[model samples]
Target chain A: MDYALNDFLMFTPEVYLRLFERTHLALEPWFWAVPVAWLVMALLLWRAPPRARRLVPVAMAAGWGLTAAIFMLQFYAPINWPVGPFAWLFALEALLLVLLALRVPPVGIGPVVLICWVAVLLALSLMTALEAGTWQALALPGVTPDMTAVTTAVLLMAWPRRWRWGLLMIPLLWCGFSVLVLWALKLWWPLIVPAAGVLIILIATFWPTSESPDNA
Target chain B: MRLPIRRRHFLLGLAATGVAVRWPRTLAGQHESPITRAIPSTGERLPVIGMGTWRTFNVGNDPVLLDERARVLELFFHSGGRLVDASPMYGSAESVVGELVERLDRSDDLFAATKVWTRDERDTRAAVAESEALWGVGRFDLMQVHNLLGWEGHLETLQAMKAEGRLRYIGVTTSHGRRHEELERIMTREPLDFVQLTYNIADREAEARLLPLAREKGIAVIANRPFQGGRLFDRVRSQPLPGWAGDAGVSGWADFFLRFIVSHPAMTCAIPATTQLAHMRENMDALYGQLPDETQRQRMINDFQEI
Candidate 1:
């Protein structure tokens, strides 16, 4: 009936890292191309024509959906039941991204926001390679949960002021959840740095002055 | 050869009286007295050592891991294990146990115990049914309210189910020594047949109140987290088990740890889960041989503390 305290502490850093390694191995040649594609997409977001800029949310939706479908629902949910609901949350986040993408392409994301996204992507990739051992086993940026979280955070900040806060909910909530998990599992340094970005956004922003569509 | 000799005598008895006399002494060691304890409510005897399916048995639809766990169950039953405890919270564990028991055709001997852990009365009813289906047991031997969640609502349903003969016993559980005051309150008020709680030698908080309360209330106690989810092993991994542990017939630290639990007079069962065959064998080995007396139980506590 009751869980042993240790049950909550299962999947130490080594075990969690192995999931990424196995996922990478399973995903293969297509997986190898994901990081390159992610880099190209981030660069395009900066100076791409409005037509190309519109594709950002579409690509971000695919990232969230893939992380949910492949990483969370398929791999992680079996061992960690808490992730089962989270898989659906990620899918819903993807749906939200689709809705946003269909709307007009907003004023381009600020240079500062794009820089933070790049930092999150690089930091996560470096940490995955460092901790998991072998750069070859690194998680694809934008295709893994940490990267998806960062991408969502950036996309939220770039949205029209009305849509930004509601859209940021999932990624911010995930940041808090990941902090607890990563802290408990003692995967400290990488999580600590990337998590600071969320803190910065929290400091700079206030609660929305106008209600979102939920009120409508 | 032994069976043939017994059969010849039985046949002679049957030929004389036209009634077959069953051989009482056919398997000598098989009758070696197993350590068992009395259930407080019905005075039924149950083996003191039981199996827990916590994180250890949560493998989901993996045939290879299922086979590995099945072999562990084989060793458990082979060593006189009877009670196998599980819950819905232990992801895929109930279904895994159900599949293993059905595949091995050993459900008859298993004492199935699980819990309902939802928030509402309707959800609790649905959860129990889901567990029954997952475990493939038409009825559970014992059903407990997990972590005392929705205890009032689920306890009502469990009591009703027990009266209707759907479950053999009703109880509640908690771990990490959380909600002890609330648990004690319920224990005093409810007509529970069992109370599962964390009661390892390392975490002996239950000894102060819950164990004594169970004794006074005539409620059977199922001790969980007996090894503290391998924390005890981790503690003594480097240090040598005290030489005096041999006096209590402890071949390894697992036996030392488990025997310390089952030896407690109030402990009806101690469920320790392990995925490895050797560890399961080690756990079951504690079931046989000598258990420690009060003096020795204290000695174990002192020794563990020293380590």
Candidate 2:
């Protein structure tokens, strides 16, 4: 028999499962704290003044930084060697979030898109929690590529259109890559759930908008 | 050829009539010679058992893990192993092999087999260069097109390289016995020195056509996934070794599975991957003792099926 494309992959689905289970198992005590932080950010986005709400990205930045340093670099990178460079990219994404949060320009998306994106993130968290069989599994949500992609989608909604693509670049790319990895590992349900969210954000962002006169 | 035969017969005369001296006293201080087979293309002899580096040797840049993997290679060589098969797709296995061999300074008897994995000519050329650099070797003994990704194009380059004295042999590899028809087509036309494919007690489909074809075409066969990626062990882990296995001189299930594989007259070698030292020894031990003849092999297969 000739070799199949899957034969070229370095790892099997078992390897990925082991890595994820290890990472989640290692983050036991910190799991509850993740949801608390997210709850606070959600409240600020819903109830705070426009200027105060600008600081929501501050929480996003902090979450991403912690995900990069504590979750990815410390926990995941050692087992999966290729993830080392990706950990640094997560750090860079954290920095970018911090810059966007501080700049706080006139940035807002339609309420409908915001609600839909938030629903996607919550569904992702629920699915992960159900799979892991614990709410504590939510602690390092940003560490998971799907959660990170969700965060990027929400952040893009608040950022101006011109800046959206640049900020969306890394997480979007990660979503695509994770889809392949998940597919190889045969984690069909988890991958399909997040893939749907990613598709929605991609369609919304790239969908042609009616300009001052619909030039095209 | 005639002189080597006389020398081989002289060595065999000193041992059992059918047995060859596998490890000379100066080499490994052993009594019974491990079984050896001829590569159909070149008539060069290699041990019937070899080491495979897939997930086992891909401990990328971790010094401690690299040292541990090095120990595995050391044990392989010390146990009279010659062929170490790996591929670029195995993460950092090629580099790990290079590091261990360079450190042990045991490249002389090592039969290094690696693969070219890309499709584009420029990428394939660069990939070969990178593999050579990672292996820290001047020449590869066998270079196979990995999974036939760009087999035709890479075959041309491999042929050219072989002509230029850059490589000793060219071949192709596959796993899980996925693409038999396409591989059979290529095998019929290509002047391949080797063909690597998955074959284990559980996955004996290769015995139907591929093995016989290799025997006919004079292409050496390298049996991979000999333990069915650890599934065979899981199946037999709790079961007692068949009573007759001891009489056949197979010590453990590993040896039983491996012996069953290499016992085929057409089979060249069985390359099994393992990281643990004890497992490596178990795998190497399969090279020793009496290989079951055709009837015994059929009985062994039927017995395994009953399990």
Candidate 3:
């Protein structure tokens, strides 16, 4: 296992990723691109079908978490191969996307995908923290799965089931608290994004649900 | 042998000759010809601190990256920068710079220059048109036969463009150690506005023939590979800045290195690539002062080797 871990982390691709990133610092503009990409995704989500709205976040969270896990696994630990429970869940999400496209989840499977993908991301976040000795770099938005999963999950979980907005407010509060922690750490734009998401969600909630599903 | 735009690729380098009309005085000798000049091809003066669109800038239009770089170019304009050189070989540099400058609403500030790399006249026209479409410019200020690839055919087209005013000037470029002989032969025969070649304290061969020929022809020279494909940087870094380097008004090793190229009478500006704003500012600073004289240039060479 030690042999496997050493060689795996020390592989050329891992070294290349580290060097390419360090050499270019291409991520510097992520301060702007992240927000811009968000605006694009948000615009994309605003007009997409309920199923697309639901699956998009779920797919995003799953993809983001899986990519993060892959990075940490390649860097800190070794995942050796790609067959596991999360792999199975991702397969299930893929299947769900097809179903959602067929209009299967009307209230939106935003909750369903959120629950599955966020669990995976949090698990990876935990493993990455355990392996790296510190979570300093891993606490940022992309470093974890889509936090939009949490927001969409909150709305989906709270609304149709008649649960008060308070029930969903727990994760919302956690999101808020994480931003505060990040800010105190002088995390800069890393914390600013989730904080902005908080404002957008608060504003979005006051918005009426007057537009029901056209074909629902 | 085939420097086809489809396969023949090269990184674009920055040059001088703008900022005459834009900002306040300081650049008293800024060349007017955008790239470099032979003699009296003079018109509106070109800025010496122009942008080179290569590597990542070669990627065809991504509105997001374009928007960010637009601000960078806007900053470039505010600082009185003018030349922007691109090539069909540089993927989409010509196009992206065009779209970028256009969107920034400051396309007029650009002294646009590009290259023809393909082997056939038909491919040459197609590539030039693509560059025109990419940048939305009707004509290019300078169009060179890139790398001397298909030089016979492309040079004919460039000659025609000159006659029709589709191009303002013509030039040629080549790199690496092997091409020096072929590059030399082309230099002796061609009427070129600018001859772009590799020159640094490290690669001293070009100084023997190319530089002298350019001086004799009255052709302007563009020095590329000022850092030897960035290998020069790796060699001298982490060492203390030479004591006398500061006496030259150089703030960093970049100016220390590039000014050596600029100081040569046979040379024009040397273009070095940097995405970092700090590095860009340092590079632009090289053009602001008097270049090194012969004795100082020799010392610059001796110091570089010692490091």
Candidate 4:
């Protein structure tokens, strides 16, 4: 049986909420899935990988910790910003992913661009948060996270400059997909997982390791 | 007579049926309310209380996160729910929904509904292609003009796609307060299978024109924001949930609001956004109880508005 501790928490909160007729939106509520997946990915990565493996988990942890802290602030005190807390927190986490990806070999201009994007995102978020007298006023802003690019960039920057240039092809694939999906769906949230999964697969598939699956 | 050929073509959707309609989840133990509507363009019996993807399911670009979301969907299907509605406006909701269906290896249980929100014909076509790609389905049960954006451009493209046999249903959507008269005119003009609009306890304006017109026009209604931006929850705050609500099988504000909308003869479903999984099950569960008759409905209206 899947021990649904999150479900239990989510489900259990209702027992008391039922007493009050009000719709109790549990602010600062945890989405057990985020941590659940994070740790799972971290465990897998720690076992695999170059020296960056150590840095990856640490950056992810810091990213999550800061994101959590921001959420806590937003939950207790509302902010008046253009974006939601979720989006801002997500950008922060994406920043960590860029940092973590850097520790692994093959850090490239893509990571730099990403870090820059995060910087801009942070600046914008900071402006919004500061403007909002209460932090709760901030909203989730628009930030599309495409891991294909980062993964492709990693492959490209890995040097040994052979036909491995085909590596960047993966992100090109995701880019083509994002164009269709974003245009068709009019939203970016659905791409989150398949893209991440593809990134993980590419990371494992291309790594200069014994476990790499042969394409041929 | 022409419809038979079309129906045959659709039934030739043997591929789709094999892929789309999983055997009902509730067939064994539970008794379900038997209210089915024929797709006017082609006679298909779709259960009215369909599922919607918005806040809860849309977590774009995160695969591992999606794996966990799988259970929410498992519950939806296991509970005998079908007819999933999504749109581009909802931000990856459709894509995430599509991904989940694929992961479940159970596209057979879905009545996929999605929408386009672009103005240009190129953009509209691009959107439809993306919808198909993200969801991993070759066709859609319904594709609507999200909030009526560039609807003229998108509607023409949808009409063309329908003619080409890519989509079975063409529809439109609008949210939160609108020029109902204009919406009515659009509904009258379009050969729409469904039209999604905001209708809730607080936003009952749809009742006056849009809904009556939908009933007369034979267009399906999808109620959105059934809680009216969570205000209904606030209004019902601290007050005791009426014992009668419990009798209707509603456990929380989400269900109470959803049931109220679906209880209407015109509504196909009420799609509420929730990020958490429990909310998904709770909202879909509202389908189990007795639909409020006119008397009880009016009583619900009176009490709700008074509050």
lDDT per residue, candidate 3, A96-164, as tens digits? 434433443224323354455445434433332333344333332332322432433333332333322
Q: What is candidate 2's lDDT per residue for B187-280, written digit by digit as tens?
A: 9999999999988888888889888999999999999989877778888878888898888778789988999999887799999998877688
Per-residue accuracy of model 4 over B1-307 as CA lDDT, tens digit each: 0111122343355346462243232322277663445555566777656666655554543343455456567656666677888766555567678767876666888888888867665698889898899889999978988877888888988899999999888898877666566778899987787888888877788888888888888887888767765557878898776778777655766767776788888887776655555666566656665677888788788877777
The worst-scoring run of ten residues by lDDT in candidate 2 chain B lies at: B1-10
What are the chain A TM-scores for all the models, listed individually? 0.82, 0.78, 0.37, 0.26
Q: Runs in model 3 with CA error above 4 Å?
A: A1-216, B1-45
In angstroms, give how far residue A90 of model 3 lies from its true place.
Answer: 20
Task: Give the per-residue Cα lDDT of candidate 3 at B90.
Answer: 61
Two-chain complex of model 1, DockQ on C-alpha atoms against the true structure: 0.15
Candidate 1 residue lDDT tens string, B1-307: 0111122343354368742232111122466656889999999889888999987787665454666677677667656788999988887789888988876677888999999978776687688899999999999999999999989989998999899998999999998788999999999999999999998988898989988899999999998999887778889988888889975568789888888998888889999998876687678777777889999999989988887
Cα deviation in Å at residue B190, candidate 2? 2.4
iRMSD of all candidate structures: 5.0, 5.0, 15.1, 15.0
Taking the tens digit of each residue's C-alpha lDDT, what string does model 3 give over B61-174? 233344445545554554466667777666445666776676666667777777887877668778788778877988887787777898878877787878888888788887
Q: Evaluate model 3 with DockQ and give the value.
A: 0.02
- Per-chain TM-score of candidate 3, chain B: 0.82
Candidate numbers sorted by DockQ from highest down? 1, 2, 4, 3
Query: TM per model?
Result: 0.77, 0.69, 0.54, 0.55
Cα shift from native, residue B101, model 1 (Å): 2.9
The best candidate in terms of TM-score: 1
Which has the greatest lDDT?
A: 1
List the DockQ of the predictions in order: 0.15, 0.13, 0.02, 0.03
Q: For residue B223, give model 2's deviation from the true position in Å.
A: 1.0
